[model samples]
Target: MAKSTTQNIRQIITKRFNGFFVIMLGAFGLLLFFLFKVVFVDGPTLKADASSKYLKERSIEAVRGNIYASDGSLLATSLPKYRLGMDFSVFKTSKMRDVFQKNMRPLAEHLSAFYKDRTADEYYYKLKSGFEQRKPYVLINMRLLDFQERKTVLTFPVFKLHPKNPIKTGVVFDKVNVRYAPFGQTAYRTVGYMKDKVRVGLEGAFDKELAGVPGHGIFEKMDKNMWRPLDGNKEILPQRGLDLHTTLDVDIQDIVELALMKSLDAYKGNYATAIVMETATGEIKAISNLMKNEKSPTGYSEFVNYAIEVSENDPGSVFKLPAMMAMLEESHMPLTATVTTGGKYTVYNKTMTDSHDYGTLTAQGVIEHSSNIGTIKLMQRVFGSKPSKWYDYLRNFHMLDPLDFQIKPVTGKPNFNVPAKWDALTYMWTSVGYSSNTSPLHLLSFYNAIANNGYWVQPIIVKNATKGNEVVIDYTQTQKRDSKPICSKETLDKIRIMLKGVVESGTGNNLKGTPYGIAGKTGTAQRRVNGNYIKGTYYVSFIGYFPVNNPKYTMLVAMDKPLGSSEGTYARQVTAPVFKDISDHIYARDMKIQRKLSGYLPDSLNNASLHHLIHPLDHSILYANLGFPRIEEDGRWLSFQLNKKEVKNYGLSFAPKKVANVVGMNLRDALFVLENQGLKVRAQGLGFVQSQSIPAGFPIQKNALITIQLH
Candidate 1:
C-alpha cells in the first residue's frame, strides 16, 4: 500500500514538470522570431535614428577674399577675433584649489589693471562665487578680444598654471570673423559694404567672386550643449574667395578727394563730385562724391556716386564741344568764319546772349568765349537747312544712349528727337547746352574722346579679378567697348585747338598762367527744378585735359548749388581753380609726368634749379650766401617770411637727424625734406601732409619708401 501511494505522487510531480518545460520552450521560440525580424527588417531605420540624435551636419564658413588697390595695397580684408571665457569648475578640483588660494588676489588685481573697467575686489568675489557654484562657463570679458589678446589672457595668473595645455588652463574662446578696412573713409562708397543682405560698390558687384563657396562637416554633441567636430569624420574644405584688383590709385584718389573737399568748403556747396580718367585706356584713376550732412554744422560725407548717377539737367557750356564737333564735320565750316554778337541776338522769338559782348567773332571765338548767341547762329547756319542732321550727328556720337559702365548705374539718356511743338527754337536751345540731359561723366567722355583723337573708349573702374595667384577674369582681354571714329582726325584736331584757345585767352583764361597747358571748357548752367529753371542756382563745372601737346589725363570738377554771389558762382571762379589745383599737384608729384618733363629739359640743366628751392636746414647757408642777415628763431624747423626785397628766416633749423614730423608741411617742403633724407616717397592728395607712414623720431632706413597723405 505505501509503494503504490509514492508512485502516484511521483507521477503527478513529473506531469507538472513536463508542462512547465513545454511553456518555457514556446516562449524561447517567440523571442528568437522577434530578434530575427529586428536584425533583418528594421536594422537600417533604427541605426539611422540613433545616428541622427548623436551626429549633426554643420556648415564651415569660407574665408572672404581681400580687396586691393591697383598697387596691391590692402583695402578690405577679414580678420579672426575671439571672445574670452573661463571654466570656473576647474577651481573645484583638488589640484586647482591650491593654485586658486595662492594667486586669486593677484589675478583679480591683474584683471582690474588690464581691463580697467572693474574693481579688484569685485572681480575676486565674482570669481570665487563662480568657483563655489561650480559654474561651467563664465564670461571673462564682454568685449571681443583679438587673437593676441586671447593668447595674452592665457598667460594670466591662474590661467598660466598650465602653460601649454588648454584643458588644464580652463580658458575658453569663441572665434568669429571681422571685416576690416585699412584706409578708413577713403573710397568708402566704392569699397562698399553689405547692408540688409544687399551689397554695395565692389563688394556688391563681385559678391559671388568675393564671397566663396561654403563647405560641410560633421559634428558630435558634447557636454554643456556644445557641439564639436567628431574625430575621424569627413570634412569638405572651403574655397577662399577670389581677390579683386581694382583700378583705383590710392594716391590719386586721395588727391581728388582733397581737392573736391576744399572746393566744396570754400564754395559752401550742397554737393560736389570729381573724376579723373586715363584718356587712352579709359581707366578711372580717381573718383569723389561728397554731400553736406544735414545733422552737423560742419560735416560733409560721401552719400552717392553723383558723377555717374546724376544726369537730369543740361550740361551747360561743356556740351559746346560736341556741338562744335558736329558743326565742323557736317558743315565743313572754317573755325575762322566770322559772326556778329552785339551783346545778344534773337532766335525764333527767343533771345540768347554771351557773358560779354564782342563786335565780331569767329566760330572758334564762339566756343572760346562761351557765346550762346554765336553758337545758336552757327547751329542755325549749319543744321537749320536739314533739322534731322543735328539729331543724326548726336546719334552717331552715341550721345543718345547710356554709357553702360560696370561700376555704377548711369542715368540721363538724351532725347534728340523732335517734339510735336518743335521749331527753330529747339535747335537753338540744344545748340548751347540746353534742352538736352547729360551727366558729368558723359560730358567728360566727350572731352575724353577729343583727347583720344575721336575714338571714344568706355570708362572702366575694375581692372581684373584673381583667385590666389591665378586670374579668373581679365578685363583687359575682354571685348573692347571702344567706338569707331566719331569724326575725322582733322575735326578732332580743330576742336582741340579751339578748346586750347578757350583755356589760353578765353573763358578759361584763369588757367593760362599754369606751367603746363590746359585745354578745357567752363560751364555755368541754370539748375532746373520741377521742369522749370531755378533762379540763382547753377551747376558750375570745368572739364578738360592737361599738357595739350600730349593728352594723358582727362578730369571733370562739378559743383551743385554753390553758395555765393553770381560772380562767385561762375565756373571760371569756382570750378576752374579746383581743376588747376589738382592739375598742378599731379604735374609736380606724378613720376610719369616728371619723366615726361625730363625729356623736355636738357640733360645738364634737368635739376639745375633744385638748389634755389628752399630747405629748412640750409636756411642760414642760403641767406649768408645771398648776403642777407640771420633772422630770429622760434622753432626747430625754419620758414621764411618774404616782404618785398626783405627776406627773414623764422627759426629755421637743419634737417632732422631722425625722421622728422612733417604732418603739417606743404607738399613742396615735405617733398624736399623727405627726398633730401635719401628716402623714396609715395605721396597722395594735394595739400599739407595729413599723415605719414613713418612716425616722427624713428631712425630713417635708406631707400625705404615713405607714404605721405595730404588733405
Candidate 2:
C-alpha cells in the first residue's frame, strides 16, 4: 500500500509541473495578441503626416448656406475663413539648428507684429504648450483675420516661405465657412442668433437644409511627429448646404425697424413692437421690436419682437372692434342705433368705466369715440347673461388659443379662468378686448380681416421660404376665407367708415391728413399681475389700415409700459404717428401710390397760401360753395350729375350749385361745381381727397368748402 501511494504522489507532481508550463505558454500567447493589436496589426491609430508617416487623416470641410431676403438681398451669408495652426514638432530639428531657429523666430515675429497685442513670445509659448500636451495640431487663431488681414498675413516674412522653403516644416492651415451678418444690430431679434456654432431663425430653422454634410479623408503619421495628407488617396466629397431665400423684404424691414426705434425713442419705454402686412395677400411686409435693457434703460437697447411677445395684458378699447362685430353679426344691430352709457356699468360685483362720458351716442359714434362702457352695454344687450355665446365667438375667431410661430416662446397666449363660476363680468370685459391676452400679431390680424373686406387671412411673417434656390416651405392663406362671414359686408363697411372717421374726426383724429387714410382703433389696457392690476403698467397700441378706401396695408404699433408719461393716450400721440410716418413713406416710395408731396407744405392752407403741387394736373385751391345741390365722395361737387330738369326754369340764370356735402367726389366733378358755384375751382394734384376744410354734413354757410382739395 505504501509503495502504491508513493507512485501516485510522484505522478501527481509530474502532472502538476506539465500543467503549469502549458498555462504559462497560453498567457504568453494572449499577451502577444494584445501587443500585435497595439503595435503591428491594426495598432491604435494616431493620425500623422502623409508623404512621411504610413498613415494619416486628410480633413475636408463642408460649406454652409447663404440667407437671402425676398428681393434677393443678402441678410446673412457664410464666407470661407481659415483657422491658422502650427506644428512645432517640425521645428524640432537638430541639424542646421541655427537656420531653423532663425527662420522660426522671424515667422513668429511677423505674426506678432501683424496681429498687434499678440507678441511673438506669447504665440511661441502657446505653441510649445500644445506640443507638450501632445496635441495633433495647435490652433494659433480661430475665426481670425478678415479677408484683407488674412491676405496680409499670408505674405508675411518667412511665414510665406512655410510648407515650402525656410523651415520645411509641417504647420498646416485649414479653411472653414463661418456665418456673418452685415446688418449686425438691425432686425437681430427676428433673424435670431447662433448658439453652439449652430445658427437659428432663418439660419437655424432651416439648419438641416442649410448645414452641409461632413467629409472624410486619410492622414498618415510622418517622421517629424506630424500629420500630412496622403497623396492620391480616395476622397469622400462633402455636400454643400443649400441657399435659403426668405420672404423678408429688406426695404420694408428697414422701415419697420426705423419706425419702432422712433416710437420707442419718443415714448421712452421698456420696449415696443410693430408689424405691417399686405391686406389682400396676408404677406408680412415687415416686423420690428425693441427691448430696452431695464438695467440700463437709456443706453442699452435690444429688439424684443413684441409682436409675438405674449406677456402683455389684452388691450381694452381695441378689442371692442371684434366685440361690436360679433354683436352686430348675432343681433343685426343697426349702425345708427343708440346706446346709453352712464359712463360706468357694474356686472357680478365688477365695475367697468369708459375713458370719458359718451352718453347716448350712436353705435357708430361709440366705436369712433372708443367708449368702453358703450361696448359692454352692447354685449349685455346682445349676449344677455349667457357667457357661452361670447366664448363661442372667441373660439370661432381662434382668439382663445395660442399661436404657433417658428420660435418656441411663451409670449402671446390668452389666459382665462374657467372654474364653473363663469359670469357676465368676464363676458363684459371680453367684449372690450380685455380680461385676456393677445399678441400684437393677433390684433393686427383681426384688423387685417376688417380691412380685407371680411376675409380673415392668417397673418404670417415668413411669406415664402426656399432651400438651395428651391422653395421648401410656404404658408397658405388663412383658412377662414371659406367659412361664414364673421361680419356682414354692410357691417364691415360701416366699421370701416367709422374707423376712418376716428382718424378723421374722432379719438384717432391726430393721424388725419396722413398720406394714406387710416382706419383702425386705439387701445390702452391696464396690466394685471398676480391677480391685481399694476398701477403704472399699461399697454398702449394703435391698430390701423392704410388707404382705407381700398385697403393695401394693415399695421399695428404697440408700446409696452411707456415710462415717464402721465397720459396713457400716448398710443395715439406716439403709436399712431409711427404708423402715419411709416405708411406715408412706404406708400409713396415703395408702393408708388402717389407722387411725393412737398415736405414744406401744411395740411390747412388759406387762400393766401399759394397752391402746393403734388402732381402736374392738380393745384391746391380753396373756395366757398354758393349753393347746395349735390356732392360726391371725393370732395368734388357733382354739378355734372345735376341737369336742367333738376335745376328747374329759374329766370335768375342761377349757376349750378356746388353741394356742401362734397365728400367722396372725383376731381373733375369737384372742379366743375367749384367753378359753377362762383367759387375758385382749384385741384390739389392727384390722390384721393383725404381732407377738407369743412366737415361733412355741414352746409357751406361762409366759405366752408374753401379748403377742399385732393390729397
Candidate 3:
C-alpha cells in the first residue's frame, strides 16, 4: 500500500511541475507580446509626451531700435549678441573623419588667434578631446560676441560654413539682444535713460518708437522651468522699433561739454549749461547741462535739464535785446535816437545805474554798452506814457510763449510778471533784464531768431525717425512757416550792427579780436536768492551767433554765480571764452570760410611754386566761390591761380610718418603738417614755406626737428 501511494504521489508531482512550467512559458509569451507592442506601436506617442507639454504663452521682446546722432554716430543701440559653441555630431559618420581631422590644427590655430584666451596647443588638446569623445555640444567660448565678431569667426577654418557643401562646421551660436551706449556719459542725460518705468529725455519722449512692440509665442515647458521653442514655430515675431536720427551733432556735443566743464571747473561754478542751435532751422546741434557734485566720481554729474528749466534767474543784460526790439517795433523809433543816460536815475523812488556814466547815448548805444540806465531812459522816452506798450510787444515777440521743444523738458511757461501786477518800477527794471526770467534754451531760441533773419520757429532735437529706409516721423515736415519775420529788415539790420558793436567796443569788448565776427550780448545778472539779489553771487551768461555777417549757428552759455567771479567781469571771465572757443572750432570747420592772404612776389618760377602749397582743401570750390577765372592747372594738390603772379595753394591728403612735400605751404600750414607727424618744427621767415632742411618722402624720426624757410 505504501509503494502504490508513493507511485501516485510521484506521478502527481511530475504532472504539477509540468503544469507550472507551461504557466511560466505563457507569462513569458505575454511579456514578449507587450514588449513588441511598446517597441513599435506606443514608442512615438510616449516619446512625444516626454518631449513636450502645454504651458503659458511667452512674450518675445522685439529688438529695440538704434538712436544715432546727426553724423550717423551711434548714441544708443540694442544689438543681438552671440556665444560660440561647437557640436561633434559630424564624428558620428566615419566618411567625414579625414576631412574633420585635416582641419584640427588650422582650426585650433585660428581659434587661438581669434580668442587670444588660450594657446594653440591648449586649443588643439581641447578640440581633440571634444572630437575624439564625440561631444554632442561643447561651449567653445562663453564670452558674448557682437554681430560682426561672430560673423568674422564664421569664416575661420573648421568653423566656416559653405552654401553648397553638405557638411556643416558643427559650430553654433546662441543669440540675445544687448543694449549699449558707445559714448559713455558724453550725452548721458540727453541720449536718455529709463528706470522703474519712468523715462527721461529722448527715451521718455519716444518710448513707443524706441522700445518696440512685444510678440507672444507658445513654447514647450522643459525640465528646470526652461522653455523650448516649438517647431512649426507658433511664435508671432516682434516688429523692430524705428531708428531715431536725432539733430544732435555728437562731435559738437562733446566739444560743448568739454568747454562748459572746463569753464565750470576753473570758476568753481555751481552749475552750468550750453546749447547750440542751427541758426536757420532751429535744430539743436548740441546741448549740455552739468551740475557740481562732490559725490560723483568726476566731481560733476548731469541730472537737471537746466538748459530748459522755467524757474531760473534773471538773464541781466541779455534781456536788453528784446527790450530794445520792443522799442524799435512799437514807436518806429530809430536805434540811433538819442537817449540821455546819467550815472544814476531814480524812477518811482527806485534807483537804476550804469557801470560808468555816459552823458548822452543813442538808442543803439544802450544795447551795445549793455547800459542799464540808457535802456531805462529809452523805455521812459518811448513807453513812459503807457508802459503797457512795452508789455504788448512781449506778446508780439513770443517771449512769454512756452516752446514745444522736441526734448519735452519745460514744466511751465516763462517766469515773467503780468502787466496787471506791474509796479511803477517794473518798466524801469524790466528794461535791463530784471524781474523776468526764462530758460537758457528759451533765451537761445530768442537769439537764434535774430540770427535766423528774425524767423521765429520752434527748436527740435530729433531730425527724423526711420525704419530701414522708410521715414516714420519726418520732424522737418512738422515745422510750420510764418508769413512775417520777428521785425522789419531795417530794424534787424540795426540790431545786427548794435550786437557787433557790443563785441567790437561795448560791454563785450573783452570778446574782441576773434578771426570770425561775433554778434551777441554779455549778461551779468544778480542772482535772486530767497527773494533777494545776492551781492557777490551772480548769473553770468553769453548768448550769440558766429560769423555775424552770415550766421550759421547760435549758442548760449550760462553759469550760476561762479565762486571766484565778481559782478563786472563774470560774463567775460566765464562764458565768453567758451563762446569764442566753440566759435573758432565752427569757423575753422566751415569750408566756405577758407581764405588765405599771400605775400606779394614777382611772377617767377620760384615764387609761382609757393602758390602750389599742399594741404587738404578743395580749391575748385574755393576758387569758384571767390569768382576767380578757372585756370588749367595739373596735379593732385588742386591749386587756384588768379595768374602766374597770384596763385593760391591747396592739397588733398598725406600719409602718416612720410615726410610731406610742403615746399609751397605757408609757415602755418608747414608747421601744422610736420608737428602732426611727431616731428618738432622750427619755422623761419614770413609767408609760405620756400624750402625745407629735410627732403620729402623720408621716414620721420622721434623728436626730429624740421626747419622750413618761408619767403
Candidate 4:
C-alpha cells in the first residue's frame, strides 16, 4: 500500500516537471523570435535611428602632437583637413531648387577651374544627379582640403551664404586630422606614419607620449547623420599630445637624401643607406634608407630602415678595423710588424685572397691598402695557434653583441659564437667581415667609438619633448655611454691613424682629396644570393668620421647590388664619393666646421649648385618670404639659376591641346598639368619626373592612361 502511494506521487511530480519544461521552451522560442525580428527585420532602421539622434557617450579625439627638427623646423605634424560634402536635400524645396538650378552651372564651372579635377559638365551632372535623387549628403569631391581651401570654397556661387537662409548654402564638411611632413618625404621613416591603426618608426616607438589622453563627452546626432557635442564646449577637454624635438637637422637630412639619391641614380643599385651622426653625442643628424621602386614616380622610396633592420651584410674589409683594434689591444702588434702576403692564404683547405697581390706589408700598410692577405696573415701570426682567442678580442669590442637599437629590434647580430664553436672555416671567414651578419648601424657604432675617444654611446633620435604649456615634451636626458671603452687610448689613436691612411692612400682613395680629412674605411663584399656568393653582384660600404683631428661627425654610406661592372662596384668608387658630397654640405653649413676650416669653404653656393629645376611657384613663395624679388614667370615648371640680385628663368611653354612635358617637373606640378587634361595617371618614384610614357605634345585625350617615372 505504501509503494503504490509513492508511484502516484512520482507520477504527479513528473507531469508537473514536463509542463514546466514546455512552458519554458515556448517562452524561449518567443524570446528568440523577438530577437530575430530586432536583429534582422528592423536592424538597419534601429541602428540608423540610434546613430541619428541618440544622446550617448562619445570620444573626443585628442589632437596628436607635432614633431620638430632640432632647429625647430616642423618635420611632422597633424593638421585639420576637411572632406567637402553637399546637402542636396535642401534643394528639394521649390524656392531652393530655383536658386540651385540658376547658380549650379556657375558653381560647377568655378569648381572645375578651382580643383581642375573634373570637367564643368561632370560636376554639374554630379550636383544635378544628387539633387534629383534627393541625396541627404553628397560628396562634392573626394579630395581633402586645407582650412584655407575650406574658406575659399565657400565663395563658390551655390555654396556661398544666403542673405537670411544660411541653410541654402548646402555646403558641409567632415573634419579629420592628416599627418604630413612639411618637407615632403624627407625623414619619412624617422618621423613615421599611422595606417589602419598601426603606427611605425618614431611614431610607433613614442605613440604613448605622442598620443595624448582622450576624453569623453555627451553627443547628440544632427541632420545629415552627423554627431555634435551636446554643449558648445566639450564635457571633458582632451589633452593635446606632447610634441617631440628630434635631433634631425633638416638641411643635413636634405643633403643626405639628395646625395644618396644621386648615388642611387649613378650606381643604379637596388638600394642604399646613408647615416650621419654627431661624433661625441651619438645624435642622429640625418639617416636615409632608400630602396629601388620601379613603381614609384621616383625610382626610389624609403620603405625600410636599412640602417637598423638587419646585419645581413658582411662587413667585408670594414671588419678589418675591429680586427686592427683587437690586435692592437691584445696582441700588442707594432705598426711596423711585417707579414708576407702574396695575396692568398688557406685555412682548413679553404682559400682567402686579395684583389691584388699585396706581396709583403707592414701592419699600417696592410690597413691602408685593405690587404685581405696581410690581414689574415697578421691575425694568424698573433692568434693562429689558438684562433679561438681571436673571437675573444672581437667579443671585447662589442662586435658580438646586439645593437638593441631604439628604432627597430636589430636581427642577424654579428655572428660570433663561443670559443667552443671556433673552427678554421669560421675563424678565417669571420676574420674578414664574413660569417657574422652585422648591420650598418652596428658597424657605424664601432667607428663612432673610435671618433669619440673610445666611449661607445648609443645612437639616439629624439632630443626632448613637451606636454602642455608650450605643448612640448622634454625627452632631453643625456644618453649614457653603452660601454666605457671600446679600446684603450693607445689603441684608439693607432686605429684612427690607420683609418685616416685608408682615406688618404687605400682602396678608399676615391675620396682622398677631401679637404676636411675623412678618416674611414671602404668595404666591398660579394653579394651572396640563395646562400651562395654571386659572381658580379656586390654590397659595398664606407664608414668613418671627418676632420680627422676634430672628429665632429661620423657617417656611413652603404649600397647593395650596384649595377655596372665589378670594377665600378667597389665601396671607394661607388659609396665614398657620396660621403664626400654630404660632408661638403655639412662643412659649408656649420659655423664650427667653417671655423675649423679657417675660411676655406666658399662664402656662397656656386651657380652649379644653385641651378634648379623646380615649380615656379616654389621659388616665388621662397623669394617672397626671403624679401627677394620674384621672377615674372608663368609655366607648369621652370629651370632657373638663383643669384644675389636678378632671378633667371629658363622659359617653358605648353600647348593647351597637347600633353604637357613633365620630365623636369616635380610630382606636384606634373600631376597638376597631366590631370588637368583629363588623363588617368599612374605615377611612381619621387622628385622630378624622369620619363613619361606618353610623349610631350601628344594630343590630349580625356580619360587616357599615362604613366610617369621620377627619380
Candidate 5:
C-alpha cells in the first residue's frame, strides 16, 4: 500500500514540473522574438529619441598622423594622455565619516593641482553633489594623471582603483594620439592648422593618407556609468598616418624667416614674403609670409598668405619677372636692342613712366634698372598689334593661371587681362608690370624657369608620402620630375648672363662677391589701392639664384610700401644684402661647395703672415661718418654704432697691410662681416675686446686669420 501511494505522488509531481518547464520555455521564446523585433525592424520606426537610444552607435576616435620636416625630423606629433573617474558607491571605506572627508580632501587637492580649470573647493563641491545625486561614475581628470600622483592615489585606502577608474579613471583616455607642432608657428601659416580636430595645409591636403583609419572596440556600459570590455569584444587595428618627405630645408627656412622679419620690421611695412627654391628641379625649399594682423600695432602680422592669396595691387614689382618673360617669348628681340625710356611715356595715348629717367638703354639695361618705359616698349614691339598673343605667352609660362601646386590658391581670376576696350598702351603697361594682378609665387616661379634653362617642373611641397610603408607620393625613386622647354637654352643663357650683369654692375651690385655668382632682377612697383596708385608706396623685390653657371637655388623677396624715398631703389639697397646673406648661408651648408675650395683655402692661408699683420686683412675698418675706408698699415678706429650695409661692406675689404689676427673689438660685429667676406672667424670670449695678434694697420689677405676676445 505504501509503495503504490509513493509512485502516484511522484508521477503527479513530475507532470506538474514538466508543464511548468514548457510554459517557461514558451515565455522565453516570445520575449526573444519581441527583443529581435525591437532591435531590427521596430527600432527604426520608433520616435527619434527612442531610436537613438536603441540604434545609434558610439564612435571610435581616429588616429592622427605624425608630421615631419623635409629631412624627417618629427615636427608635429601626438602624445598619450590618461582619463580617470570613480564610482562613488563602490569605494568601500569602513572608517565612514572619519576617513571620508580626509580622503576626499586629498583627491580634491590632486584635482586642483593638476587642472587649472577648477579649484579644490569646486572639486569637493562637485564630488559631494555627485554622491548626493547617486551618480554612478564621476570624471576627475580629463587627461592623464601624473604618474607619481596616480601612484599615490592608488595606495590610498578603499579607493577601488580600476586603473580604468578613480585615480586613473574609467573615462577611457585609451592612449589617444593628438597633433603637436614642435617648431611652433615656424611655417605655421603654410603648414595650416587643424579645423575641428582635422589637419589642414599639407597636413589637410593629404589628410586622407596622413590620418590613419581608427580601430573599433566593443564595450558595455557598467551599472556605475563606467565602460568595460565586453565578453567578446570586436576590434580593428588602427592604421597610422603616412610619413611625408618634403623639399624644405630647415636651415634655408631659417634664413627666409630671418630676412622676412628684418624686412617687415625695417620698413614698418604692411607685409613681407620670401620664397627659396631649387632652380633645376623646381623644388620649393622655403616659403614665408610675414603679414600684420589688424590689431598689430605695426602692420607686420596679417593672417593672409601673400604667397598664393590674391588681392589687387599689393604685389608690387615682383610681377615684372613674368611680364618680362612674356615679352621675351613673344618678341624675338636681341637683349642688347635699344629702347627709349623717360621717367614716364604715353602708351595707347596713356602716359607711362619708368621708375627712373632711363633715357635710351639696351633691353638688358632696362631690366638692370627695372625700367618701366623700356618694358612697355618691348611689349609694344611684341603685342601692340595683337594683345591676345601676350596673354598666350603668359599662359604658356603659367603666369595667368594657378601654379597647380598641392595648395589651392586663394583669390580672383587666374589670368592677366587687357579689357576688350583695351588700348595699344594697355599691352605696354602690362609688359611693364602694370594693370595686372599676381602673387609673389608667380614671379618666383617664372624666375626659376629662367634659372632652369627654360625647363618648367611642377613645384610640390610634399616630396613623398607613405601609407603603412607603401609609397604614396614616391619622391625617392619615383620622383615627379617634370621637364619642358618653355624657352630656348640660348634665351636662358642670355637672360642669365644679363641678370649676372645686373648684380655685377647695375642695380643689384650689392650681390657681388656673394661667394656664388647670382643671376636675378630687381623690381619696384607703386601700390595701386582702390583704382589709383599710391605715389609713395613701393614694393621692392629681388629674385635670383647662385652659381649662375650651374644654377642651384632661386629665391624671391617682396616688401610692401617700404618707408622713405627712392622709388625702385629699395631692393638694390635694402633687399639685395639680405639676398646675399641667404645665398651664402645655404651654399655653405648642403652643397659641399666649400669642399671644392678647401684645397685652395689652405694654400692661401700659408701665404698669410701674422707679425707684419696689423688691422686683420679681411677686417673691414669703419670710421664715424665716413662711408668705408681702405684699411692700410695705419688702422682708423671704427664707430661703435654702424648700419647693416656700411658694416657689411667694410668687412668685405681686404687689408692693404700684411695679414694679422684680430683678437680684440666687437666679436659679434666682426663675425658678421668676416662671414660675409667668406673668411672664417673663431671667437673665445664673453664680452667685447681683450687682446690682439694683428695690429691696427696690417694687411690681412683673403681668408686670413681673425681671432677676437671679449672683455
Candidate 6:
C-alpha cells in the first residue's frame, strides 16, 4: 500500500511542473512580437520626440561693417566685450570645498585690491555663500569687463588656479558687441547711430549694407542647464558687412567745426552752420552745425544738422545769386544796367530798403552792395512782363529741387513752388530772398553751381562702400547724375566777376586782404519768429570760394540770431571773418593748394628753400627761369617778397640774428633756422609753428632737441 501512494505523488508533481514551463514560453513569444513592432513602426517618431526635447537652435550674429574717413581712418566700428561670472557649483564636492575655503580670503583680498570697488570681507562672504548654495553663476561685477580686463582677472588667485578644471573655480563669460567711435563727437551725426530701432544719418541710410546677414546653428543639451553645439552639420558661418569710405576730410572738418564754434561763442548766436564742398566734384569735405546750449549759457555743442535739415526761412541776401542769374539769363540784361536806391524803395504796397544809401548803381554794383531795393528793381524790370519766367529760371537752376543726398535722415528740400495767388509784390519779395524757405545746403549748392561754371552736380557725402579691401560699391564709378548748365558760359563768367567785386569792394570786403582771393556774397536778413518778422533776430551768412581766379572749394557759413552790437550782427562781421579764417587755414594746409601755389615758381626751382633768405644764385635762377623781373643785388643774403605783379628782392643783414620769431614760421623754415643754429628739431602737426619748447633768442646748444608745435 505505501509503494502505490508514492508513485501517484510523483506523477502529479511532473504534470504541474510541465504546465508552468508552457506558460513561461507563451509569455516570451508575446514580448518578442511587440519588440519587433516597435522597432520597425515607431522608431522615427520616438527619435524625433527625443530630439525635440534635447536639441536647441541658436543664431550667430554677423559682424557689422565699419565706417571710415576718406583717408581710411576708423570712424565707427564694433568692439566685442564680455561679462565675467563665476559658477560656484564646482565647490559642491568636499575636496573643492576644502580648497575654496583655503583660498577664499586671499582671492577676496586680491579682487578688492584690483577692482577697488568692494571690501574684502563683503566679497568673501558673498562668494562663500554662493559656493555653499551651489549657485551656477554669480556675477563677478556689475560692470562688464573689456578683453584686457577679463584676461587680467583670469590671473587672480582662484581663477588662475584652474581654467580647464572647473572643480577648483568655475569661470564663465558672456560676449556682447558695442559700437565704438574712435573719433568721438566728430561727425557724430554724419557717422550716425541706431536708437530705438530707428536709424539716423549714414547708419540709417545704409543699414541694409551695414547690418550683415545672420547665420544659424544647432546645439544639443549636455546637462540640465548646459547646451553644447553639435560637432558637424550644425553651423552656418556669418558674413561681415561692407565698410564705407566717406568723402569727409577729418582735418578740414575739425577746422570748420572749431571756426564755427568760435563764431558762435563770439556772437552768442542761437546756432551756426558751415559746409565745405569740392567745386567740380560736389564732394562735401566738411560740414558742421552747432547750437548754443541753454543750460550752459556760454557753451555751444552739436545739435541737429542745421546745414541740411533746418529750412524755416528764406535764405537771406544769399538768394540774390539766383535772382541775378534769372535776370541775366531771361532778360539778356547786361551786368552794367543801373538801378537807383535811396535807402528805401517801394514795390506795390511793400517797401524794400538798402542798408546804405546808393543813388544809382549798375546791376553788378547792386549785388556788391546787397541792396534789396536795387535787386528788386532789376528783377521787376526783367521779369515784370512774364513773372512765371522768373520761377522757371529758378527751377532750371535746380534751386527748387531736393538735394537727394545718400545720407540717412534725408536732407531737407527747399520750397520754390509758385503761389496760387500771384500778387504784384510777389516777385519783389522773392527777388530779395524773403518769400521762400531753403536750407543752408540748398544755398550752398546753388553757389557751388555758379563756381562750377553753371553746371549743377549733386553733392555727395559718401564716396564708396568696400568689402574687405575690395570695393563693392563705388559712387564715383556709378553713372553720374546728369548735370545741367543753368546759364550761358558768358553769363556765368559775368556773375563770377560780380561776386569777386563783392569780396574786393562790397559786402565781403573784409575778406579782401586774405592770403588768397575770395569771391562770395554776404547776406543779412531779419528772421521770422512765429510767422512774424523779429526786429533784432537775423540770419547772417557768407558764401564763396577761394583763389577766385581758379576756384577749388565752395563754402557757406551762416549764423542765426547773433547777439551783439549792430556791426556784429552783419554778415561781414560775423560770417565773413569766419569764412576768411577757414579759407586762410585751408590754404595753408591743403597739399593740393600748396602744390598749386608752388607751381607758380619755376619748375627747376619747384622744391626751392622756403627759408627767409635764398641764395643769390637761386634768386637769379628763379627770376630768369620764371621771367620775373630780375633785381641786381650784390649782397650775400637775399629775401624774396612775392606779389601778384613780381617777386622782389631785399638784402638781409646777416649777423647771427638770434632766432627771430620762429614761432609762426612754417615747419621747413623753422627747422632750417633751428638746425642752422646747430640745434635738433622735433616738430608736431603739419602747418605753421604754434609754439616752441625752446625760447627764441636762447643760446643754442649743440645738437640739443627742440620741440615745436604746429597747427
**Candidates' lDDT values, in order?**
0.77, 0.64, 0.77, 0.78, 0.63, 0.77
For residues 550-646, what per-residue lDDT tens digits would candidate 4 score against the true structure?
8999999999989987777889789989999999889875656544424443545433345556654455545554454455566445666667545
Best by lDDT: 4
Candidate 4 or 3, higher lDDT: 4
Which stretches of model 2 miss by more than 4 angstroms? 1-62, 88-99, 124-136, 162-171, 197-200, 212-235, 293-303, 406-408, 411-413, 417-421, 467-469, 472-485, 595-711
Instruction: Write the residue-wise lDDT of candidate 2 on 414-487 in tens digits.
Output: 66555265654777777777767767777777788888878776655554445555766554532234255556
Backbone clash tally for model 5? 35
TM-score: model 3 vs. ground truth: 0.66
Window of ten residues with lowest summed lDDT in model 5: 610-619
lDDT string for model 3 (521-635, tens) is 9998889987898777889899999878888889998888788736544787789888988778766656665456488545475344334543333345455564544444453
Model 1 per-residue lDDT tens digits across residues 1-711: 999999999999999999989889989998888888788878878888877776788887788899987777677888888766666666656877777867878988988877778999998987787677777667767676666567777778978878778756667776667776666556777788777787777788788888899788897654345555665878998898889888887767767777787788788887888889888888888888888664421245676777877466678888887888899999788989998887888755777777788778999998899988888888888888776777778877767777777665535455454544567688668878888777777778878888888888888888888888899998776625555788988788789889999998899999997767899999988888889998788888999997677888999999988988876798999899999988887877554543333346464543342212233444554555545557553325665454444565555354454776677676646755776565666766556788999987788765678889877
**Candidate 4: where are CA atoms >4 Å away?**
1-56, 86-142, 162-170, 219-234, 294-297, 385-389, 410-415, 468-473, 476-478, 595-711
In model 6, the worst 10-residue window by lDDT is 292-301
Which lDDT value does model 2 have at 205? 62
| Lowest summed lDDT window (length 10), candidate 1 | 606-615
All candidates: TM-score? 0.74, 0.71, 0.66, 0.74, 0.71, 0.74
Which regions in candidate 3 have their CA more than 4 angstroms from the true location? 1-54, 81-176, 219-233, 292-300, 410-412, 565-569, 596-711
CA shift of 639, model 4, Å: 15
Model 2: how far residue 51 lies from native, Å: 20
